[model samples]
Target: MTVLTKPWIWSCVAAAVAYALILGLTSGRGAGELAYAALSFGAFAAIVGLGQMLVITLGPGNVDLSVPATMTLAATLALKAMGTDPGTAMLGLVIALFVGFGVGIANYALIYFLRLPPIIATLAASLVYQSLAIWSNRGLRIKPPSGLADFATGRFLGLPNVAWVGLFLAIVVWVVLERSVWGRWLLATGQNMRAARLAGVPVELVRALTYISVAVFSALTGYLLASFSGGAALNMGAEYLLMSIAVVVVGGSSIAGGNSNVPGVWGAALFMFLVVSMLNSYGAGAGVRNVLTGTIIIGIVIAASTRRVRA
Candidate 1:
């Protein structure tokens, strides 16, 4: 019943604090800026973690990808919306969500309907998304739209708007996944599709919908990123796909399926963000960042897998 009773939670907190301290000591960046960076990473990681939750908890075939594409497309759609009237912007969000959903549906159809492997289907879809983003951006950076740029830069009660959005999203997702009947069905389907189908759980539908949900979340994350970054560009979603998976795995979810821990996802995301930000502060290059991040994630996954094996 006590908070400290959870080893996973305590580990995440300790990791985050230690990361910040290390950065502060090594880079002379000051505790204040390091703290702010930690928050920023936490918010970003939350969105990424959500994507991981969707894929892992809702995957139909023990695999999920296309996260990066969905996010990039969503950010592009938001940018396009900014070029339109107020009414259009609203419509654009809807369209963006639809597009994201469509991506998911396509994945499902390819895997179940066409009998393609999940990895193949998702990888193909990811390529399509990457292609679309590259073509649209025309090798240019997504600039912040003048009208909506304020939302990204504006801070409310000391937190950036993106942070607030992340908070709201986390709460909403927590409620939906924990309180809804459909949520039970989702978990059931993820745990055992054949069993769920035998019990008349509409297995394929749930599986497809899971992908759709992930797509929607990815898109939403993209929208937030565009708003926060002042626009979107190519490969914007690439970094997140790996990070999201790492977060989920580190947070204690098996890549294969079953468990869904919302709070753990939050902690893992924060911890990851802190690690990356801390490394950045230490003047680590992107290559170094990738190496360190990947190493850490692999170690976590191995440890988790070992624990599962023992238990």
Candidate 2:
């Protein structure tokens, strides 16, 4: 019971249960294979989810709707630049991060200067970013550099290399949020913007940095995903917009903000992958899978919210 109250725990439990059911149906076959697949695919969700978690932690109304577009644009540009080169992974990465930074700055400018709501600002910016992506490559699928592709698709120490990167990032984020002054300021800002400003928390700066961080995360994911998938596609990142938010929310981050769960985000990422696989094993179609996934996400979010209010 004590453990259950920890917001991150439930996601892990759900994942375990889903895996168990899937194995039961197959009479315990493919256990390792399923686990590997979940980690491999879930890494992207976890990376973006961590970024989204930070934005949401700044409170309600703060989110990046431009993630998919950012990913698409960054990947498109990075892949185009790298273009079958052998040692240009670093170049592609630099392009990706730069694109992310620019997008983040653009997002912040819209919110701060235009005084627009974050949702409206980001949603509007997404169109521009998407157009930029479409314009940059004109729907061409550019393959990543061979070395970059190998690193993205390769494994290490018995786990997917991408999963290792995700885990490392999760650790870094957890440390920053748990141990840094910036983390304190962010929490204060999220709890009450006016009060935090009164307390000299640099609320605006916090907001700016948070938005930038999320954009960078989205871009990095875009770069890696493009590499992993063999090329950059116009729609490679389309699925992750909702996925990033869902993982954050279902991981027990407070929807109203001021609270975050790094571990929960990763757990929720794994759960997302496992649940989909389980649904497929049970013969659920794509629509049914989506409906069930949405239902589960809503249920968990509601449960976490109610618990938070009660506590």
Candidate 3:
């Protein structure tokens, strides 16, 4: 049976329901606000998950560690460029996209020419990016332009604007992965870069595009997070490193690549964000909370590998 017809998806759904039940039972203090928080975080997870799907599923043997740094940089730049001009926010967003693409190119160049491992290359790039972020502001916090704040803080259909952005991204990625030749090449390259190269698939180009695409998405996510929080901080992206990886891994994508679990991965992202949200709601402290979240992510990684081996 296909993974879609298997128990994993249902398991994710069950986990989500169980999470809701737990939240339901503990309702008393600001439950509504807590619920909104859960939903908002879940949306953010979805956006991060999309980036992961594109990266890992597009290049089976490769994975990126620069997601957090790229995101932080893009967001900070976007907020900085906005600079109190509401009308220029669009231009700022465009710049953020180019920034993301630039990061991707840097990674691709290192991996392709220097033959650096994806993880190592991304790690080095992340350090450099983080350093630049610090150097740019001298460790100062950067706020979104005043006029641009309303979009992040505003609600449509009683949901945060970020949710809308996530929904749009999901739709866009789904279409690209399911319908386009570029998407097909991504999957093909991930499944077997050697075979793809022999088939004249432009394997290097595809891989570079995948990294670039992921970087772009991560940048957007960071921008949203910063806007939501009212400012971008130097350390903001650090915490997201683990959370983003967890979302993708739990969503059913393998670290080794080959198989792509699009829907499952999306569900897993939501499942994880809900887990963190609930844990926080229950007054779990940061240390305990991260431990629990990390444990769950490790469990998922093992389970996913076991499933693949059994298959």
Which is the leading candidate under lDDT?
Answer: 2
- TM-score of each model, in listed order: 0.85, 0.97, 0.88
Give the TM-score ranking, best first: 2, 3, 1
How does residue 135 of candidate 1 score in lDDT?
A: 73
Model 1 pairs whose backbones collide: 144-230
Q: Write the residue-wise lDDT of candidate 3 on 1-311 in tens digits.
A: 67544324642763576467556767555656755665677777778778877788865457778988987888777777776566877877887788888998998889989999888999999999888777776655667776567787777888778777887887887778779988788788888889988988988888888888878888887887887788777777786777677666777766666556666655676677677667776788999998987787667666666666676
- lDDT (10s digit) by residue, model 1, range 167-283: 788887778778987778878877887787899887777777777777787887777677667667777787887777777777766666766767667777777877776677677
Model 2 — which ten-residue stretch has the worst lDDT? 302-311
Q: After superposition, how far is residue 289 of candidate 3 from its true place, in Å?
A: 3.5
- Would you list the clashing residue pairs of candidate 3? 251-265
Provide the lDDT at 226 for model 1. Answer: 71
Every candidate's lDDT: 0.71, 0.92, 0.75
The parts of candidate 3 lying over 4 Å away from their true place are 1-11, 27-32, 59-61, 283-288, 298-311
What order do you get sorting by lDDT, best first?
Answer: 2, 3, 1
Better of 1 and 3 by TM-score: 3
Q: Can you tell me which runs of candidate 1 are displaced by over 4 Å?
A: 1-11, 23-29, 59-61, 84-91, 282-292, 298-311
Determine which window of 10 residues in candidate 1 has minimal summed lDDT. 2-11
